[model samples]
Target: MAFVSSERIIPISDGNGLEGGGAFLPITPTPNDVWNGWAHSGAWIIQNGFNGGGKDNVTSAPSQAAQNSVTVSDPVTQHTAADPVDVYTGAFLYDGPGLKVGNGEAPMALDYRPHYSTNWRLQNTAKIGYGWTHSYDIYATERHASDVDIHTASVAEIAPYWVTAQYLLDTVTKIPTAKEVALRVIAARWATRQVLKAKVTVALGERRIEFHRLSDGSYMSPSRFRVALEKSPEGVFTASFKHGNSIEFGGPNAHASKIVDQYGNECTFAYADDGLASVTDAYNRTLTFGYTLGALSSVTDSTGRSVTYSRGSTFDMVDADGGVLSFEMDTYGHQEILSVRDGLDRVVVVNLYDVFHRVWAQQPLGDALKPTYFGYAPGLAHETDAWENPSWTKFDSRGRRVQTVDMLGNVATWV
Candidate 1:
């Protein structure tokens, strides 16, 4: 059978917390100076790129698409000469740090981040076309960031004009009471539906679609669309593309989850648990899995960082080869081998942070086994060998040593 272990983290705040922000203390694993390196480790992962393998380079996930890149077209607009319909459409993608699990045949991959760029163009009948590209990159622990952009002009006229307005309804849990939502510039209604409750009706061309939220009184946001419908002579009914109208449902959390890397600001594990999707923090930074596990095991956000929990927790052991294994974390917060020839052999313990984006781990050998220096890089980037020394080996991407020599001449860095 599969042996499982899990982690949970929550916040603790006092009313007297600082303004513009509230202090959050970790609530688990009896947090003490022993685990003080958590945040420093998180920064390491953001900077050096987490996975042992260096495949997650800056351009690993480079994505490029021109209007004609996918399906080339220069269709004229449906506007008259007076209005002179000029359609303008642009494609943009904001790719963040993503994890690529190994198939064993390949090396384990983590924090593979590429620059996120938005490419857009605006055009009208009077002009040819113009477009611009903006790109952003985070360096050194998902904190340090820089961006470079290139603006270009095009000889081809921009795509014809088209307008799309999306109306979003959030889960009832999100809206405290009577919250007013505005659907600005309602163009020709394409489709609508109540995602959480059938009582709500969304109409497209001329029919209505039923939407519902979870039984727990959660309201389905506009993004949690089920189907598009319209009000008919008799009642709300479903509609097809008979009049060039179409309906499509947006995935859950499609809109609410986004990480903004604004200057002088840092955030991690920002997401919505609406059964939709998860979002990373501003720097796409995270710690090791071990660290995350530790945090979750105690259900306390010791770093007082932000995190989003999507669902309940379950424990599962995985082997180095990426296969399911039989190992467990004992009540005392140590890993035990369930199927080993020797009963309950000591194993590695993992703690996670930044919503499991970063991980930290340690062997259950007790404080005596603690390393002189806690290695940097989100969690334990080097599981090949147990961290054993307080050596100053971490260097910046530019090969500059990051370990600061403290007052006692002790050079160290903590996350």
Candidate 2:
């Protein structure tokens, strides 16, 4: 049975992505390269604009809100003086990359990509309303990246595609591959006793949702996702995501000798008498890593630029450009990252966090002020945003949206 993969992506870093109490990395666009992009978890979510033939563009799970285009006379703020704004409540989306099984037809649909590749950068923000979207399955292989459009195919395209139906059905993946995972989605709209239980599609009716790392293959960083590593019998430290791909670290060597990705790509490490000495990601690429006084002194990534870390308690980095990316930690309690500062230490990138470590509010990239506030649904967005979180423009467990409150406190509901 081909299980359906619901699409959702929450940060593996406390499932909220506000590590180091800040957001945005000026030095590197993709900061999750340290763990090879395992910083976020793919979630199972509702499908709102999908399953329709030609009403929408399911070919690409765009996060753009229809409200952005439509102007509204309704006031945004709760007060009477508030003027009407052009933006409307956005839609809820299962935003990310993903894979799908064949449609339930005879020559079942083959691998289908719901979005763009990992390299494509997109934003999934919430202003008023939200929408449903899909993302990469953690275990989806290259086999899932077919650009075939079954929803709006031309007669010519469908004729040729149907002609090869026998070949498609004969070569479909029937079981889990080592590098792939079944999409076990939080299938329901509301919270059950299991707290928004997740369900997987099965027997040729399912989709395969995958999770992708947020790295641009850059140097390592001090900020790390608070995930545990599984020690292998071979003494390797393995970190695998829920229903996504995995990366392995720390081999027989006292230190992690290698960092290997799911596709077998790896960066091998070597150490000196003092500490780490060298790292070779490929035959042609070698980097120098060193430690001083038992602490990481300097590291040079493939960019050939070295960033030095202070020996002090703060995890700060001084890039070659003279800019500093600093993380302030709490002295007491859990000692979480208090805030993140840039080289100037003037404009704040990330400011606050909720108990769940989600972004309570933060400035958008480039814009230093006027932070976008965020409030989460009770359970995981994957499991219950449809019903529990009215911010999303999707139907819930009750098959209806109870009510919606915008950033301005405007309220709307479906009765």
Name the top TM-score candidate: 2
Error of 2 at 272 (Å): 5.5
lDDT of 1 at 157: 9
Model 1 root mean square deviation, Cα atoms: 25.3
Error of 2 at 152 (Å): 34
Off by over 4 Å in 1: 1-36, 41-162, 165-188, 191-344, 348-358, 364-415
Candidate 1 lDDT for residue 107:
12
Q: Per-residue lDDT for 182-275 in model 1, tens only?
A: 2321222222221112233332211223333323333232332333333234332322232232322222211111222223232323222222
Q: Where in model 2 is the C-alpha error above 4 Å?
A: 1-267, 272-276, 301-304, 311-314, 363-369, 380-415
lDDT of 2 by residue, 8-72 (tens): 33222222221111221122222322211111112221124222212222132323341333334
Cα lDDT, all candidates: 0.23, 0.32
